[model samples]
Target: MPRLEEITPDNVSAAVDIKVGPEQEAFVAPVVTSLAEAYASRRTAWPRLVYDDDRAVAFVMGNFDPDNETEAFRCGIWRLNVDRAEQGKGYGRFAVLAFCEEARRRGHRRVTVLWEQGEGGPEAFYLRLGFRPTGEVLFGETVGELLL
Candidate 1:
């Protein structure tokens, strides 16, 4: 199973090397962008690089309300991406599970995700993971929630 690791100064460069397929470019932001936001956003964004053992395979960014209030949004996934060569190998699902576990550990009762509409988008994938649409939209993406 893949695991999430903190992006330290030593490994941050390697984390930025990870990339998703061109077709998925619209679905996720690059690691560099996510990391930059994480840095600028302070405690609100928790960014990590996903690894299959020692091999880096993906990047995931989780956003949360630092005060445990909905200042911006609840605890939820902000970004997820697997390298083009590593897609369809279940690393994405592994990252989701890790994110959910982390959310639960933080006392969140549920986690929400916003995804853009399109064929081959993550709506169905999130649904399969037990996320139900909340009939809400964020930044033009549908909001889906999973009870923790």
Candidate 2:
């Protein structure tokens, strides 16, 4: 199994090179840049880069936020990606599971994942990991949630 590590400037370039397919390129390009910024920010967001041995293979970026005026923390899982050459080897699933576990460890009660509308891969993958669609779409992205 590949081990997950925190994203850093040293590995950010390699992580940004991971791609799913030609169709996903346009979708993931901007996301990669945004994730890099989040990683460099002061917020509590956790952006991770996964690796097998010393090679970068996947990534997951997310953060914990307080809901409304309550003390409850709602976790938001942002971007998740596994290299096309490394897909179907369980890397993506492992990354998501690890991210969720980390979110729980951070005291979040729920973790939400947002997927692009046309990305069947993400929808199916998240579903397989126990996330259910919330019937809510935000800015062309579908929202799914898994209670921790």
Candidate 3:
């Protein structure tokens, strides 16, 4: 199973090097962009590098704000990307499970995610991971939630 490690000074460069294929560039931002957003939302975001054994294979950024009552979708995954070479190997699914576990550990009853609607989008993948549409649209993306 793949595990998540915080992007630290020692491994930030490797995490930044993680990428998806050209076709997926339109669906998800590069790791650098995700890192920048992490910084911008530092108060709630937890940016991580996904590792399988000793190799870095993916990048994930999530928000955990149990106190965010104003926004139902506040505590959720913000970004997720598995390097093209690592796709279809269950890494993304492992990462989602890990994120949900983390949210539950932090006392959250559920986790949520927002994704764009397109061919390469992760709507189906998230659904397979037990997430369901919340019927809430924000900024052109659909919101999905998974009760923990």
Candidate 4:
């Protein structure tokens, strides 16, 4: 069974080791980079690792800042990286569902995600998860939202 774990000294290194395939790399940032961003935005960043027993399988980060000037950034999936070896094993969807639950718990009515469109991008996967494009684009990434 896979479970989401809060990043800690004991598991921080394991989280950092998570990686996506080379083709998917252009779609998202790595766990280490996401961790750095989380540190910089500790007040709003929520980073977690998905572990199947003792094995780390994926990393997910959400940014929750209700007062942010940008509506999309107020609550959204900031980064998600599933290990190259763990792709298609449901870890990515699990991480995303976990993030959505967290958003609802945080009093958010919806959570948004920005995905770049390309042959190997996550646009299709996110859409399949029920995130509808809001017709907004930020920094060249299509803005998508899922009502909670």
Best by lDDT: 4
Models 1 onward score TM values of: 0.92, 0.84, 0.93, 0.97
- Across 19-103, the per-residue lDDT of candidate 1 in tens digits comes to 8777778888888989889999977888888888889998888887856655227688999888888888988888888998998
Q: What lDDT score belongs to each candidate, Candidate 1 first?
A: 0.84, 0.74, 0.86, 0.93
TM-score of 2: 0.84
**Model 4 vs truth, CA RMSD:** 0.8
How many residue pairs clash in each candidate at the backbone level? 0, 0, 0, 0
State the local distance difference test value for candidate 4. 0.93
lDDT by residue (tens digit), candidate 3, 63-89: 877678746546788889899999999
- What is residue 4's positional error in candidate 4, in angstroms? 0.9
Which pairs in model 1 have colliding backbones?
none
Show the lowest summed lDDT stretch of 10 residues, model 2.
Answer: 65-74
lDDT of 4 by residue, 53-135 (tens): 88999999999999999999999999999899989999989999999989988889999999999998998899999999999
lDDT of 1 at 54: 85
lDDT tens digits, residues 18-100, model 2?
Answer: 77677676545444775756857537567888899988888777766655342222577767777888888898888888888
Put the candidates in TM-score order, highest first. Answer: 4, 3, 1, 2
**Which ten residues in a row are the worst by lDDT in model 4?**
16-25
